[model samples]
Target chain A: MSEPEKALAARSLASCHDCALVVRLPAGRAHVAARCPRCGAKVHRRKVDSLARTWALVITAAMLYVPANIYPVMTVTSLGKSQSDTIMSGAIYLLQHGMWPLALVVFVASVLVPLLKLAALSGLLISVQRGSSWRPRDRTRLYRITEVVGPWSMVDIYVVTILMALVSLGQLASIEAGLGAVFFAGVVILTLLAAESFDPRLIWDRAEASHARS
Target chain B: MPEADGREHASPAVADAVIEERSRLSIVWVIPIVAVLVGTWLAYRAFTERGPLVTITFESAAGLEAGKTKVKYKDVEIGAVEQIDLSADLSGVVVQARLGREATRYLTENTRFWVVRAQVSAGRVSGLSTLFSGAYIGIDPSTEGRPQRHFQGLPVAPVVTSDVPGRLFTLRAKAGGSLEVGSPVYYRSADVGDVVASELDESGNHVTVKVFLRAPHDQRVRKNTRFWNVSGIDLRLSPEGLELDTVSLTSLLIGGAAFDTPKDQDPGGPVEEGAVFELYPNRRAMLQPKLTVKRPFLLHFEGSVGGLVDGAPVEFRGIQVGEVRNVRLEFDADTNKLRIPVLIELQPERIALNSGGAVVSIGMDEVRRNWDDLVARGMRAQLQSGNLLTGQLAIGLDFHPDAPPAKINWDAPIPELPTIPSPIEELKTGLSQFVKRLSEVPLEQVGNNLNKTLEQLERTLASANALIAPDSEAGSELRRLLRDLADAAQSIRLLADHLEQHPEDLIRGKGAE
Candidate 1:
């Protein structure tokens, strides 16, 4: 094996020690499958297609979001009469009725939180690609936040669902779910997948290697 | 030892590697995407859900719930309560409502809003008429005006007294009994309108009540409409019988307002807004001239005058023209006189019914010019009892064209009205005077005259007696002849005895043999 390969194998073996796997270095820089020598188990490495798959899913979700907002998310009918309202209108209605705090919470959960998570995840991804050596702790915290907040982005959608279900008044009044709900659901799922597909090991590897050199 | 050291070194690296990994996805794009969806949805809703916004101000917002109340037209829901807010002054609650897009066409500047609840009345009327119906805003649309933002609260319920439209007037009174907002209003004896609302004014001294009267009937209400509280039975002794006068059976139980337009005047201009009227009692004793006429003239009177009483209405012709002022008695120059003089003032307009005269002209072109002559020729003032059973007197004037004119001495007699004594009083005085004249005849002088008459009768009686008495004869002169005379006397006596015994024999002369 070449000296660099030996060093890489040694690092991989050391990292896998807790799992009962000792990696063996190959001679050249070509990709090779390594197994833990101590436990005779195959070591799993980050997938080569992970980032692309996540990017595809997130971009698809992003595209769907446009139509979701542009169309009404719910249709309400009362006594043979039909009407529709969107998120902003609903919030404003609540505010006008002296439900300000509730309105604020809904606004943040449905709009601001989702957007923040998206931006943060994107930033983390870009930094990871450029091999940035910035504050690793902060980036880790940011990732954690994105993952945690991703599911909550469905708050508006859930609210719509519940309202549509509860407010069905037969002929007197009724509520129907709309296209915006589907799009919002897509955003949540895609964001969650994006967060999951990210590889944290890559961050520590670079960080530790630089620390060793220093 | 070397492997252990390497493992420790790589552990830190593994942790760092995990942090460094990132997804290739550009998640930032999701924000705009979601925003666009929400925004588009909202815009569509805004375009489709069109409605008019109306703001109503309320003094108290005790039971109002935002997003719950609704605006209704003809009991059909047209919109919903969007929100509620405090007025800038914090003195009231301002409610904002949003009607459906189609409903916007119906909203106009005349729309009204009010709170409704159950009300109780002392007249034994109770219950919730509008319960389960919920509080609703009402609209009265005007075709000409644009939609307005601010609206006045019409807290009063719609009055449905009559079908015609007319100006509404309000009145206030100290309700002797309980009264309700929807009480009926009567004019003369006809039902004209109803009470719309009753509320205490700021001063709280009186309760202002709103009443509505319908069209042609409302026109009957003139400036001189006299309002009286006619809610109870009024007992009046009319000439016919004991009269029970009441507006209505229900009004007698509860209470209501009654007014009348004077017969003479063309119904005065429509009742002015916010006009206040006094409430007169239904009793005849309370029938005094309205304040408009009280200030001008004051007159006094005395005696048992025939034509006037407390309620004896003064009349110009046969029509009632004025009223009696007072009735009293006075003593002048040690002579007691029953005096009753009436103070009569004519209603200038009613006086126009009489003929025109230089001194009493009423500017009526249609009036006959010789009014004084007509009055002198046709009018006769007399005392007429209201009801014989009740003994209430009323002065009546009648046209007595054929009857001789009253001997009213303009120059010699007292200027006051002659005291016409009541029949009972006249009978009593005549009887007493007859007794006095009889008692004045001298009984003692009559007794003396009777004694003189008796003495003269006795003297005449004595003279007659002396003539009838027996007398002495020439006696003893002829004693010698006594024997012969005796013999003759004896013979005569025998004959006299014989004649007395037989009168028929004497006429025949048989005793002389």
Candidate 2:
């Protein structure tokens, strides 16, 4: 759902999905297409198939996660010798070399943060599917958190890109991204899309339905 | 209660839609499936690349541990110790190591494994860099040998490698002396190989050393090649000059062996592997064809043979014929005389003789036949000082013209050859005899002759004096004549004085010459 339509759902008023303008739908027995006067954009009460789209994107991101960690993100050649390390191993190499602070940062962004976002998204999906209202406020807060943190997972991808660009000393030392980097970046981008396609109004919709039933 | 947003009131048909109809299998599920498949492949690749396991038995696992110690081939780790277990006999440690797949081809029966660490032996210092890099099991692979998975660890590093292109030979010496494993073996004073192994012989009477001569050096080892221990400094001080011989400074520190095929003699042919050669004590000893056939003969010397020891050279006309085999003191109860029995070995080959233009040697029969004649001709053995400073004496055979008459005891068990006193002893005795003969000379008879001659001379002198006496008639006449002679001497003296006073007077006839 767009921002304007999301706030309009609780008050029984039709608001533009793109802009915050409220609009009245013409009375009709057939299909009615509501258009906002101010923004001239199609206004819907909720995003079309919001749950399915978000679920598909989230699943795709989860799928790509495997390859991202399995393959080496880039190869580093130094002094005519080339060495390739995976993300986990790269962090380990840094730690072994006594750069543990950088290793910790990499670990959190590449491993822990991504895994937590997936879990939080899964939890939110499950709660909405079951029509449960348990800790609805906290669940909404968690959704916001997952959205804000989703882009930061791309830090590892950025670091790899920068290293690839900067470390080009030809045979002396050159770093080129590997297959893992592609999959990992795909995961980050897909997760961001999944967060965007999710309709937050669905969270309130399930709680109200459960409250009315009780 | 149902329409919270109030934006849409769905038809009953739409509201009654089944959840399964609304939910559809997404296309994105294919990604997870592909991810699962690729992940499995990567895991399998990692698993298949690990190679076969082999067990190495070592006397002790010093600096070795399970999963930590590496099995390295040329300083690159090819495997690691996976488990350490006690041998069946519990006498040593057996380590199981998993080699990488890349090392499979090198697993051969003849491949050697040894622990490399800092080793300081009398022969050399090696593998010192391993001290910092940590100890590792070294692999020396042989490509031609049959494949094997089990190996026995070497106790020490192999000094001679198979790839070094060398031939192995056995050398027997009375003792190990200072030559050790890794001790350099020299050919013509150039280091060629090393003593690979040393062990006591089964009889324990001698030490058998296994030596390697690498490549072209192996070609240098002829059947007639001579090897000797050149461990310590060899110093010789002689009347001609001083000579010092050493192979190298390392040879002095660790004790090494050197070999050479003498230039003068034929080297015969290249020796085969496992050929047994004798290691002589020094260069001088090695140069001589090792005298294997020795004829023993006993000699009885009358004087002390204190300086004559076994191994002392026995020379015939200043040429070494053999060595003093044994020396003993015997008290002859029958003769009540001290007899010194000396046993010497004579090598007939060492006594060279010239026939026509070529050098020939006399046979043993000829020596025996001619021996009796030589004894009759005053040929005897004597002790001569070979080196006065060291008090070393050698048995010298020569014709002592003044030696006491004696016959060779051909009937004796040992074929005893009579010995004459040494020249020093002979000189001492001859001086003493000369002194005794002088003491027997008659001093009284000589004194009587001298007194008679003196009395006769005195009587003659008295008669002669009476003729000139002034009291007798003949004496007075003689006196008058003597006075006339004195008057003439006085006139001559006066004339010499007048001449001295005036040269013109003599020239003018001393007034009337």
Cα error of candidate 1 at position A132, Å? 5.1
**Span of ten consecutive residues with least summed lDDT in model 2 chain B:** B12-21
Tens digits of per-residue lDDT for model 2, B1-513: 345334354222111111112224555556556656776777798689979898899999887777567888766879888999999999999989999998888889988888887898765678786665456788887877889999999988888767688899999998787888888998767889899888998999999998998888788888888889898787765321355878888888887888888888898976788899988877867877756678788988766676677878888888888888999888989999887789998886786555676855568678777988998898888888777776778888888777788887777778887787788878878987998897787778878998999999999999888876768888888888899999999999998898888888756765564
Local accuracy of candidate 1 as per-residue lDDT tens digits, B39-138: 6787698778867788888886655667666676665777777888999999888888887787665456755566654455544342253454345565
Return the clash pairs for model 2, or none. B509-B513
lDDT of 1 by residue, A1-214 (tens): 4454445655543334447443433323223444555554444455434455455556656666565565667777776445565666666777899999998987787767767777787777677676666898889988888888788878788878898889988877888987767767777787788788777665665675566556
TM-score, one value per model: 0.48, 0.67
For candidate 2, give the DockQ.
0.11
What would the DockQ be for model 1? 0.05
In terms of lDDT, the poorest run of 10 residues in model 1 chain B is B294-303
Worst 10 residues of 1 chain A by lDDT: A22-31
Question: All predictions: root-mean-square deviation over Cα?
Answer: 14.4, 9.8
Candidate 1 stretches with Cα past 4 Å from truth are: A1-214, B1-34, B40-58, B64-112, B122-181, B185-242, B245-310, B313-339, B344-380, B397-419, B422-425, B431-513
Residue A196 displacement in candidate 1 (angstroms): 6.6
